[model samples]
Target: LVSEEELARVEARLRSINQFAPVMHCTHSSVSVDQVLNIHGFDLQRALKASPELLNTSAAPTKHDARVSSVSLDQSAPRHLRTVQKGELDLDLLQEWIGELLNNSGEDIFRMKGVLAVAHAGKRFVYHAVHMTFNGCFDEPWDDEARESKLVFIGK
Candidate 1:
């Protein structure tokens, strides 16, 4: 379990990101994908284009890809596990959803972070994105001991 102070620090980091960044999200659900390319505070469109796969959910992703699990704007609420695709994802649809979140002003989103399970570079990968920033991305063997991705979002 994470300590209260640790959680507080993490939250602070998230708030900093929100103050300066704009991200993409899913309309049907609270899940959103951070545009890493545009994270240094760059063009929203360019950021979306750089990793269009992160935005859309209409294109069939490979059998394995970095995917969101679930999102919640309630900190006390447990974030349910969600996968973009049972086997693969539709990138276009996912992207469209993200775009919707960006345009919605009343969205209760405050902060988000998750571990993305991905298959890349001929190996399994794990990606962590906090707020709209890429926290970490690494390739690992499938047998490594790692917990499933978890995320907690604070509502406005």
Candidate 2:
């Protein structure tokens, strides 16, 4: 069960996204939503070709900066797509897929700021990271479109 503090933290984070404050691990990176959509479209196509399970995910334009959008695990995608990749033999072969992403894609990796869905301790987790360092994860899963994981990375 999510404690009141945890819920409040999540709500606060969601509410304050547009404030441009100094969030740990994430910078107030700036970019257009179209850029994010293009990145998602290209990278996810690659991810899908490498592992079909990713077809279960979706990328939608969020109301953040006109240039801010997000990638989410679609409700119809296989449950395995929601699992974090930690190893090769895992149910959906996701570990290999993520490794490929990290190894082959550098140009598309603008800046690493945003929320991530991480699976740990036998439950789904959500995390917000900025600049790839300041990070925090919650033990609950996000099942709604409004609460989906979002990250904004600006290219240098």
Candidate 3:
């Protein structure tokens, strides 16, 4: 769902990636094909050395007036990893947040997703959205996996 130019535009907006958790960098699309399939020996060390900024990131600041943009929320939720402190997020509050996001957008929000750990419950919620359409449901109970919330929204 992202192109090279779009990725570049995003990369241009980063400051110190203080957390080292930017979604795109964490979710890089496999480029091994450009190596293995093309018979070019894949060299991880060479690639890392060549892209110095990937190791020390600081780039032109983002201009939100531009077409494409992003949002990151470090909202605390019960049992979630975005923060260590315990917090509560009831279903009503969850819906309120989602409603505001969809309603506030000028159809500029193309997508979103959330993995939530609810207050007073052993289960979690998984939600997805595209424009005004969204779907959500209670998922399996908490497991050994660390609960985390992740959302990605892209728009023009």
Per-prediction tally of clashes: 18, 9, 0
Q: Tens-digit lDDT track for model 3 on 1-156?
A: 679898776776663333222333435555544433555444656656755555554765545767777765555444454543435477798789889878888398877777777777677888888888889988898788556555566676
Estimate, for each residue in 1-99, the C-alpha lDDT of model 2 and write its tens digit: 567797679768865752322223223656555545544334555555765664454744345454443454343346676533322123234335444
Candidate 3 Cα deviation (angstroms), residue 37 = 26
Model 3, position 35, has a per-residue lDDT of: 38
Question: Which sections of candidate 3 miss by over 4 Å?
Answer: 1-66, 74-86
Rank by lDDT (best first)? 3, 1, 2
lDDT of each: 0.45, 0.44, 0.67
- What tens-digit string does per-residue lDDT give for candidate 1 at 1-156? 567797678767876645445434335545534545434675667656656665678877657333423443332234363432222223355345544653562244444444333433323334333344333444565466442333444334
Off by over 4 Å in 2: 1-71, 76-92, 111-121, 125-156
As for lDDT, the candidate ahead, 2 or 3, is 3
Ten-residue region with minimum lDDT total, candidate 3: 15-24
C-alpha TM-scores of all predictions:
0.28, 0.26, 0.47
Off by over 4 Å in 1: 1-96, 105-107, 119-143, 146-149
RMSD of each: 19.8, 18.3, 10.3
How many residue pairs of model 2 clash at the backbone? 9
